[model samples]
Target: MSLLEKQPNTSSEFEVDSQRRHEQDAHLDSKLRTLRLLDGARAGATLLALLMGLAVLGTTGHALQAYNTSRFDASAGGAAWLSMWPDNGAFDVKPTVALVVGASLVVLSNVIALTSHHRFVRARLAAAHTPLTFSAPFVGLVVAIVAVILFYVANQSATADTLLSWSCRWRFLNTASPAPQFASLCRASHAGVDLAILLIPVEFAAFVLAGFELKLQRYTAAYTHARKTPSPVLA
Candidate 1:
């Protein structure tokens, strides 16, 4: 009777151990899935920033070209009222170039980070907790600031008493109107500015999301490490 009871007890102990291991595996799977979702979100935000940056570059390039090609017909009577020269400051492409460079760096950094996610998490797990030294957030911040400057420049160019404003005002006028000469250029500049404004928020979100993802990774690593570590032995 004693031997039969002992055999049943041994089988019950094995069943409990198997159940514990299954639970642990399930928990680990859940954590991995969560991490994947976060990484995906970070990637999405970064890609959007890249697209917006490219768009700004295109619109600004067009504006710059249009401005250079614009000519004034002093023969027209309204030529006295219309300025042939567009606002040089407003149409400058240098700022747009800077914005694009920053955005490209952000995308490249994100790619590198995604590829190294597993290794990064593993390192975090093995090492003591430390602050992240990633530069994505800082780059994103700079990009956002540049975008703001672009927006301000564009807004001022569009609204101020500049040639761009003049062109827009007379855009619907007759074909003989001198405004037509500057209209297209001004429109491109306005479009570029609008895109830059949009970029501000997008860039901010991208960096913010990246920062959040880092925190999540750190937390996950620490949790995993804690679980793997054995408890202190009792005296």
Candidate 2:
């Protein structure tokens, strides 16, 4: 071919290469965002759930232990048995149930995250840039809702216990006996028990937050795609 003809062909080939490179870069960028969703955020969520689950799991053991202890009653000491928690007796059920439910969700979150995000640690596809597929958002949504409900149930149980305990007579049943007094430390301990009981539910909330983060992940992915794709040109 003549030099002039070859020149035009080279120019055309160069343009094609440039377009191909641009598309490849855009594709790579999209995949990176997907990795961040699955690996970065999702992994973080899984870790959060695992940690929360461990915490609530420990509380479950403690609650079970407390169940074996004596119940507070009329003959009980004034400030010592003032926790006002289900552990005070076998009559309460909410806190125990809350502990189980929260732990279940924590396990579920970790399972979903690990199973879906396995590709991050091990390549499952021929193309390393392929984005990880996300499952339904409903799984996380249900977990989040149930977790919140259980959390409130536990809190409500604690509140009722506290009110009832406070109203109980703190006096010894004997001749010329007066109402017993609680020390400042005991008073703080009473409040501390109430707050400490809430820790399990709070950890459960963290588990739910990790689950709900998937919603944010979806929105972010959609926004990223929109920004990467060029707008349609009207002729």
Best by lDDT: 1
lDDT of 1 by residue, 1-235 (tens): 8999899889999999899878887987887787778667766766676676667667666654454444434434446534544354544345444544554554455444444445666475534212222355456557667655754565464434443455566566544443344556567656766776777677677667667667777777887898799989899
lDDT by residue (42-71, candidate 2, tens digit) is: 456455555555555555434443333323
Q: In model 2, what is the error at residue 194, expressed in angstroms?
A: 11
How accurate locally, in lDDT, is each candidate? 0.59, 0.47
Can you give the lDDT of residue 144 in candidate 2?
41
Residue-level lDDT for 12 in candidate 2: 97
How well does each candidate superpose onto the true structure, as a TM-score?
Answer: 0.62, 0.47
